[model samples]
Target chain A: MAVLDRDTINAVREGFTRHRLSWIDTLPFLFAALMYFFAARYLPLGTQVMIQVAFALSLDLALGYGGIDSLGHVAFFGMGAYAAGLYALYVSSEPLSGLAVAACIGALTGLVTGPLVLRARGLTVVMLTLAIATMLHELANTSAMKPITGGADGLFGFKIAPVFGMFSFDLYGRTAYWYSLGVVAFVFIICKLVVNSPFGLAVRGMRDNPVRMRMLGVNVTARLVTLYCVSGALAAMAGGLSAQVTKLVGLDSLAFLVSGNALVMLILGGAGRLYGAIVGATVFVALSDRAAAIDPFNWLFAVGGVLILAVRFAPQGIVGLIADWSQRLGWVRR
Target chain B: MAAPALAIEGISKNFGGLRVSRDISLSLPVGARHALIGPNGAGKTTLVNLISGLLQPSSGRIALDGVDITNLAPERRVGLGLARTFQISSLFPSLTVAENVGLAFEARFGLDRRLWGRVRSRPEIVEGTAALLQSLGLLELARKRVADLPYGQRRLVEIALVLALEPKTLLLDEPAAGLAVSDRGALLDLLLRLPEALTILVIEHDMSLVFRLAQRITVLVEGQVMTEGSVADIRADPRVRDVYLGTRSHG
Candidate 1:
């Protein structure tokens, strides 16, 4: 009774600064680090997986946790690729700075478009995101923008500086692997902080019952806009890493296929959970690589088959399946 | 004299050609326990919607603590110490009860934007969630997910979630709906135990529960206040019996 009194209420809240240690969070990073060492021959594939993981994570924040389903999340990725590519060519060719610049552009795009796009509900918001990404894609494809964007030919002719003025991005993609790994770790950390924070719960509450959230004094649109900006920035960093590693920004970077692939990867992995993106990225990228090597054009059939199976059997996702098993085994309570 | 907890003056709302609320007016002084009761389609929920800023009144003003809040956004009204619950249980199905109840403190304490800290580790949130749950006799269910709870327990959680915000006024739309007899008893006891600082307006079909919980009753029939008086006065009124009480029996 005493505790429920208004006087006992702490008007100012603190203690949100500490980062608690969790075995679950470190497991993915450990696996990524170990793979970099043990799977040296497959660094290129591993690197691509890491980038996908990073990109998928960004989408997970928007679509999974925030419930802002974006079909064209590749907008940020494309913007980042172009931003980093252009920055490398014209500015300094510094990898970190270029990545930062791309991230800013991505964040800026989200900030600019968030209020407008998030204004729509449900399918309309998804369509608006798709439209925005497509418009950017078309703009980059146009001849008028070719001088800057390199148009249909894609952006290249830029040398990415050796990461941190030391490690060269060699033919083996060793440098790129480490760099992308770091980005995944960093992005995962950011998402961990967000999804576990009060803001994160508020977003989830809004996702479930927006009217209840409104009655609780939360600005749902404003909160989602902020999440969109964060997600966009993280995704841009993923794109920037791709540009830095490959030294090429192609039309495919901003293509609709890239966005669709990300969505599928997220769904396959499971949405909302932090580890969903990681698992999804690893499985999808590895499978896609293997399938593409065999069929090239017809590989999507294999991917489609797996997706249908996943939807039916593991709708909550691979991580969710693991969780269910653990719970059933009395490893965790319901 | 410190201004009524809530006051609505001649508020009316129309949808297309349909009048959902007509020149409806009600006021709740500080610490008032009122019930808004009516048959189905009598616009009880409509009036509540208008008060909570979910639906705008075509005319008239709503005041909270002497401040005109008719134009306030629904979310903004909450900042002014107004809160509500739906007849249908609206809760974060996947989140734990502690998380759901902690959401209010999360927003009110301005921690909603803190993107670095885990919600559970924060002492303020942890202690506040525990305290609220304890006071409501819901501590045992704190860690349980809302989706896993029974319907009766979920209703109780919904109320606790609303009360977590510590709003001065609470608008409950059918708080006891679909509750078993024992569940209704628990809800009644919890409501009775609430502090005097809170003012509650409950919309209910359960006449017995309303008779026990609410001190003042406002009866609505077809978008109009059919009668308003003390609980005993309304219970004894022959007109109320003729209009509402005749068919609406108590257990």
Candidate 2:
């Protein structure tokens, strides 16, 4: 395939521009943004606000578009958090600078490990990602990087400075919430542009059939690596946002449970549908919060059972279920 | 006048102790419609696979248009003007018939990276794909997805896909396979009407279609070339009669 020219790129971007404000197209971001804004005003301080949204989006990209069943995505998220925390504590307190460092570190880690994980297909890919996440979690718990990462105690008390010297991060949770909301909106737009690009088609085609894409002269590995890096950077940005909001970074972010939760969110939302990620994230977090209010220890079991049922009865996730119902009702047809 | 469009020199492929293809060599000159026929285990498909670069030969060289393409990847071979159709219908089922053919046009034109533009909106790709599909009697089904099309229509779309590549040499494996008699005749007629500058190699089990379309015939049996000649010569050969036609009555 030839390189995309100006006309083609413009055509693609234009295609997305037309659908930018369509009801279904805009709902995910709008809903998520509104919820974050409201939560910023109402919720108690010290909440890990951005973690669910970031995890949801990253998982969506990896599994939905990339067709990779990654259970190690949280590794990038946790690494990003730690990287941002380290930058805030040591390099610079500037939130933007911390975010930049996190993104770079996340992307680099993804680039280095993506090929090894993606080389395997189906169940193997899932298993490999799980292994990687587990390893990262163990590494974070070790004493080797104790001074920097805080080892078992984890990194804490790292202050997030203003946004480019313009907005100071207040203790009332207003600044962090808006900052994260803005970042999510920006990343969502970028992801939308990417997944709608020719690159997106290629990725989807890879999901459908890698052999066919290769026969069509698509560099399958390169595309996978590119996607991995992009996802990594986004996940890292989310992590940085989480670190800034929560004022701490911990090994729990890298744990298998965290990765598993992200996978559940992606699948619960719908594997390939972009908005499914947001839906999944929202439902998951909301349900967890509600269940915890009732009984904290038993919520995991309840959530796990619901997740199993979702996979069994609604394999396509909630979005898929809704689409199926809509089709049955003749509401929309493709 | 020049080197044959494709020349396979003593190509052999062995799978462990099983000899899949043994000392197979054939030259297909420009415009020649050469048919390879064999029984159940005759390695006809295997030979096509080897030539198409899906499988490597244990020993031999394959040259296309005087260029050695023995080690080239299948897609690169396509870039070098070699195209093949699968025995079973192979198509992008989710894509529209036009898009399926357009992919080949895009590949040939090197426009694969123009990802954002609507593929069907490209005038060149659309016109060329439409014309090819029209020629293959698939114009009416152009807007339909391959998955939604009938088996015969899908096969026609597959032919259109290969045609869209504008290859110098076309390798069709069982193009008439699973088609109705009338559809088989139409496919054979399409093959016969192909431009004389294009070299065609076909692997078929249908003796009538083979005799009707092939300018020359090569018979393979038990992974070896049993015989090769014109249709009449092949028909008259006792060895071919004993191995293929003669043995059929018992079944």
DockQ of each: 0.44, 0.28
Q: What is the DockQ score of candidate 2, to 2 decimals?
A: 0.28
TM-score of each: 0.94, 0.88
Q: Candidate 2, residues B1-251: lDDT per residue as tens digits?
A: 79889999998999999999999989988888899987888999999899888899999999999999999887788888888888888777766666666666776676655536544346666566655655666656766767898787778878777787788999899998899887877787788878888899999878888888888999999989988899999988988888887767521
Best by DockQ: 1
Evaluated on chain B only, what are the TM-scores of all the candidate structures, in order?
0.96, 0.96
How do the residues A98-193 of candidate 1 rate in per-residue lDDT, one tens digit apiece? 988988999999999899899777899889999999999999988899999998888888998787899888898888888888878888888877
Candidate 1 residues lying further than 4 Å off, grouped into runs, are A2-21, A24-26, B249-251
Best by TM-score: 1
